[model samples]
Target: MTEFVRVLLPLAPAVPLVLALLGLLLRRPTSLLPLAALPGLAAAFVSPTGEIISLPWLLLGISFRLDPLGAVFLGFASLLWTLAGLYAYAYLGGKQGEGRFCLFWNLTLAGTSGTFVAADAATFYLSFALLSLAAYGLVVHERSKAAWRAGRVYIVLAIFGETCLLLGLLLGANAADSLLIDDVRAALAVSPWRDAAILALLMGFGLKAGLVPLHVWLPLAHSAAPVPASAVLSGVIVKAGLIGLIRFLPIDALPSWADTLLWLGLATAWSGILLGLPQRQPKAVLAYSTMSQMGLMVAVLGAGFGAGVAGTTMATALYATHHGLAKGALFLAVGVVAAGAGRAAIPLLVVVAVLGAAIAGMPFTGGALAKLAIKDSLGSGPVGLLASLSAIGTMLLMLRTLVLLVAQRPPAAVAHASAGLIGPFVATAAAALVVPWLLFPVLTGRPLAYAFASPVIWDALWPIFVAVVIASPAFLRSIAVGDIAGPVEAVLRRVGGSWTAWHPPRPAIDGPRLLTRLVKPAQSLETWLAGSAASGSALLLVAVLLGFAALI
Candidate 1:
């Protein structure tokens, strides 16, 4: 039985991939597609921890494993994918392009499941690339101009991140002299190229993790993709990067790098909140919140790295699990609340708000337990204070989400939620609340007693109280980067028009005339600098000429 279960671990992902291939041959079977996630769900519960499955016959000796850390991530990621599958079934029903959507759906599912279990560098990168690329199909499923734009940006970054991962892997493999993840990190600790390798890994994974500037694709992709796809994207896809950082970086080996990570995480944490404050779209708000939540998770990992503690891995996973499930639920609620009416609306709104608050570390919630789990890792100092402020900002973000959700309620008579749609969300929301409590003991080795302690509860509540005290209706209004960009674009357009009006295309002159005479040299210089090779030569020539003139 033990051996059989171990074999089934890799099969979890293999099942969906097989289904995806089968989908290519047969008619689109909508009803059967969601069942593809069942194997992953089973693997999450039944796969023995610390078991490794190596396949020398496949993908150049690929390996998969289920250590406690991977299992923590695997559990929630599988759960979210499963729920998103069911939700997609209902959400995409009778819609156009169902077949194509189903294909990408299973392909993405396979990649997501495979990524969690992958134990080797090559296998992890393959799975990561697979999901990152496959999701481009999902992002562009609607084929709207916006969807295409999002897809273009997503694919560009996905390729860029993959390139980074490739370089990092090459450097890491060379340093470690092994392909296994553990061996790579072990070798990385002592390698001469450690800093370069780490920087490469950070940029590669950080792009996927939605670290700032790289994060612009997130809101665009989330808002453009379908609801169920949005849930998985926000909830599970970003966790790939989290898992990457967790697996690749040697927390015990680099304290200075860890401090660098701490500041980066802090900046990402606050940047998301500040940027999200002005966004009006519910999905966009949730997207930025995903970035904010990821920032917190990165901070946990940084703190762990700084302290050179191995146990902080579990803390990071716990925090990620909580955020993953809650954010997934919140994204799904956007669809549910929009589709629901009257009395059902209020209850749905309440449920959404509760889950959102969980992201903000509401008392008696998984978020609270997650906060408590990592308290020691963060330390009660300036970083801790900033973490607290991040929590309050999360409260504001969630509050803004709830207000937006309430505003989406239909004006018609009360209509109950579809069993198809609401069922997955409610189950996810329930898991978001219950699973953390169950896993807290196992993940952290702390007794359940510590969770319910008054001090812990109070520590969680104060952030919520502060957020509530400062929050207002006006503050909840939708704001976005476009607000600033919109005006800037207008100004640029006016300037360009003025420049064009002034210049007026030089009147087709063969030789340089009055206005064109002075501009001729500048245009020649501009054209010369525009050439890649010429630009370098031009600078050197200018330097030589200046030096010669100086000598004279």
Candidate 2:
């Protein structure tokens, strides 16, 4: 049994990875590419949790296992990748970059799916690195100027994040005296360099998670990346950092930092909403929403940490899983909304409304399931209150996104809409709606009916009502970065542009033009300089300067 599970675990990532390599030579085998994610999705369900497998010969000894925590990450990440791959195949059929897109798309899927199941620092780092680096291809796949710009920002920040992660892993593994992730985390409780290691881990993961100040990349990247790539980027890839923190941060040992993480999470949550509300495009709006949702997830982790709750890990995983499905669906729907026009778009739009509302924690939906799963850990305290408030902001952000999307006309660039394209969007929406409800009872150890009780339903509804009221003319008619980095990324391009604009020189140096106009120095001077007279004068000058300095 153990051997069978081990083989299956590695096959999850290996299948897609091999496909990615083979895709280079194949003639646009996109239809078959969607199956690459099948192994990962199967792993999420079939691979027994805690059945760890080690590859001693592979890159400093890497290992993999699927714990309860990993299952959630793997389940959602794999599901999103599968659906997005399917959508991409249909969306880009006969398009120019289909072959190139398929290659990176599978590569990214392999990395993301691997991160969840990774059991050692080496495996996690390499998987995380592959996801981070290979995604550059997806971002710049369009080869547009904007695509290139987003790719540049994504890569630059990605490199910095890699450095921080490597440092943290090195210090952590050294302290633990083991390459296994569990051992490293266990050592974090008492390691002499705990603070340094934690700081590096947070920065490295936080940057990828799109936390405030480091989040500028999300907006540009999402807006520029193709719809399928954007779906995975926002949906699954960003969660890499969150999972890293979950795996490595010794939150149980260093509970002192709980409030710190909590506040940072809240700040990120609201920052995303504030920035997203003003966005004119659905993609940009969703990008900021990703930031806010990620922040709230962090805040949940922190709150659970501070409270010393048992379910912190599970609660966070649940939240991330829910967000991944809903957000991915929303991004993919961007394509659906643009492709479906007039009356045809109405059903798709309705699905969008449900998914958006679910994001806002609407009652009896996936977001409600997420909120319910976490509320026990959060309690009815200030942090919970703040989290609830952020839901209102999310409601507004989604409402804005819906409005913007509704306004888009059918773009001619897309092939006339097909079932292949719309099917994935609908399937994702259905999965987002159905899967969690099925899992909630088992994960929370509560009756499924507990979620749908009248009071529980009301708690979810009020936020949606409040948000809608605010969106009304009376309140949110013109509704809305620690997150400053995303908005100012454009300014990075013109660094020193205005300050260094070509201004007349202030005569800081003697000009060659002035000297050139003067008659050339006599050839005699050159002749004399070649003699001992010039050499003696130069030597005397050096001697005088030395004597003068010594005297002074």
Q: Give the whole-model CA lDDT for all candidates, comma-separated.
A: 0.80, 0.80
Per-residue alpha-carbon lDDT of candidate 2 for residues 183-298, written as tens digits (9 for 90 to 100): 99999879999889888888789888987666767887888899989999999999999999889998866777677778888999998887788777789889999999999988
Query: lDDT of model 2 at residue 39?
Result: 81
Candidate 1 lDDT? 0.80
Q: Per-residue error at 363 for model 1, in Å?
A: 1.0
RMSD of 2: 13.1
Task: Give lDDT: candidate 2, residue 530.
Answer: 36
Give one digit per residue, the lDDT tens place, for model 1 in 1-552: 877788778887898888887776655455657688777778788888876788899857878998878778878888888888888878886678887888898888889888889888999989999999999999999898568657855776677778778888889989887888999988888888888888889877887888764666687788889998999899989999988998998756788888877888888888789878778788888888898888878887898779766578898889889888989999899888877744666677888888988888898888888888888888889998899889999999899888777777776665656889989889989999888998889889899888788888888999999999999867744454322222222333344557888887755456546667656654553443333222243234433322332233
